[model samples]
Structure formats: structure tokens, C-alpha cells
Target: MAFTNNFSTSFHWWDRIFGTDTKYREYRARVKAAKKAMSKEQQLEFERKLMAQVEAEGIVAEAEAEKMSLLGGNKKSKV
Candidate 1:
């Protein structure tokens, strides 16, 4: 959720057929709002907890955690 994008790659079919994507999208919005309400330390703690939850659920790959910007774009290098 902190990664700022909504997707389930490793188990995409599970996410689509079972409909977890909708719930995950909603949860992401909540995550952003929650972080906005917390101090820096609290936000870090919250993200840690959130990361654990998502990792356990297998919603995305470990690579998603390292991304600070949205995936797939052409801001500086447009083709």
C-alpha cells in the first residue's frame, strides 16, 4: 500500500478471480490516510506493520517494497 500502486503480480489470477484487488485498493487508500495522521516515527512503525501484513498475504513481490515512485511511466523519457 505504501508503494502507492495497486497490483498483485505473483498471484494475479487469484487476485482477479477471487476479487481481492478491490479490497486491496480500498485498503491502500486507508493506508495513505492513516500514515498522514501519524508522526514520522509512527508512520515508519505503521509501514513496517503494514509491510508484514502484505508480505504474509503475498499481495506483491519483495521488489515492490523498494519502489518509491509509481511503476511504468515516461515523465522524463517519453517514447
Candidate 2:
């Protein structure tokens, strides 16, 4: 359906398995387009809901620290 780059030369798995293949690229593009369409506000709302659930379980602090570390921030000092 959607054509972008040279699917034949871009992908190399086709020659190894069977022949030329472009189906994977189409599937990937569709998934990426869907993700790009999601609004930032929707993402934030989902995060808020998730954080509230974690807070209710008394693990919000731990979860937040983990998230910060993943984003290259320093974890809490043991001292």
C-alpha cells in the first residue's frame, strides 16, 4: 500500500529465505504511523492514571526512581 524507500534493496532477508519481500516494511510503517498519531495529551493522561495506580499500591516512589534512572537521572543517594 504505502511506498517509501526501495523496499527491495533496503531489506536483505528476502534473498536469504525465499525471494523479494516487502510485506514486512508495510506492516512496520503502519504500526509506526499509528504510534505517531497518538496525541501527547493522551500519553500524559495514560501516564497519570498509571502513576495513580502505582501510588495507591505504595510503590510510586520506587517506580518514579526507576523511571528517572532510565532517563539518565541520578537515583536516590543511599547516604
Local distance difference test values of all predictions, in order: 0.63, 0.50
lDDT, residue 33, model 2: 65
Q: Which pairs clash in the backbone of model 1?
A: none
The candidate maximizing lDDT is: 1
Model 2, residue 67: displacement in angstroms?
28
User: What ranges in model 2 sit over 4 Å off?
Assistant: 1-37, 59-79
Query: Candidate 1 — which residues are off by over 4 angstroms?
Result: 1-20, 59-79
Model 2, 1-79: lDDT tens digits are: 2222223554566533663344444445655565576787865665566445544544544455566774544655565
Model 2 residue 68 lDDT score: 74
lDDT of 1 by residue, 1-79 (tens): 4222335577767776766577576667978999889999998899788778766655454444534335533334346
Best by TM-score, which number? 1
